[model samples]
Target: MVLNLGGFKFEWKQTSEIAIETDFGINSQERIANFEALLSAKLGSQSINLNGQTLPFAQDGQEALKPLYALAELRQSLPLVTGLGKYLGRFAIEKISENRSVFAPNGAFFTQTFSLTLRRDYDADIA
Candidate 1:
């Protein structure tokens, strides 16, 4: 597995990317960069996308994807305890896209392609 978020393991499949964005304020009079907005990086809003495919070996495609569905429905932030190398933070599911292809005799999916978009959840309570 490449990473485990909140307890759901992410196995190798396709590709993953992490994105970080920042905003800066400028002084019109000085014509130069002035100050950065509070939480300029938008830590809690930054998101990452994980793409993968699930194949039925001993279990159906729907069964293999149950965990992911559960996580997305929770609508809560979860801690990052393993993988993802040096980066450590909380995350919440922002979106989930799945494509099911190939079907079994009973109509269960044989293979499923999925993409998970997760938003960073900053631990700080900025009030």
Candidate 2:
């Protein structure tokens, strides 16, 4: 599967999971026997977990995470690309955590695993 966050293309690892959510409201009013209102569409945000993956090449640890760090700092909407399709809108970077597994000769992290969370933008289109 291919994933594109804004313009950054990520290399997928062997293991990954995609979660999709939909919300609805059930009405218990005495007038109606049973009624359900669609609170939201399948347009709900998707949470993806890219567990245990190496960071892209860079001069050092900081450099490798520079782009990702920038995205985290922006905290703005971004275009999200999924294998099934593509979504254009705001995507907020929820989190970015790293785990160092290997070190370079200069004592910099050569191999590191990073986790990221992105939230989709909500608008009237879903309603």
**Candidate of highest TM-score:** 1
Candidates in order, TM-scores: namely 0.67, 0.60
Per-residue lDDT for 3-119 in model 1, tens only?
787788766553344444422433233334675444333322456677777766543336777887898788887765445464456778888888888777988776777778777
Q: How much is the lDDT of residue 105 in candidate 2?
A: 83
Clashes of each: 0, 3
Instruction: List lDDT for all candidates, in order.
Output: 0.65, 0.58
lDDT of 2 by residue, 4-98 (tens): 67666665552244444333333333445666543433433444444445543542334565676787787776767765676645567788777
> Model 1 off-target regions past 4 Å?
13-44, 58-61, 81-87, 124-127
Give the TM-score comparing model 2 with the true structure, all chains together: 0.60
Q: After superposition, how far is residue 67 of candidate 2 from its true place, in Å?
A: 0.9
**RMSD vs true structure, all candidates:** 5.3, 5.5
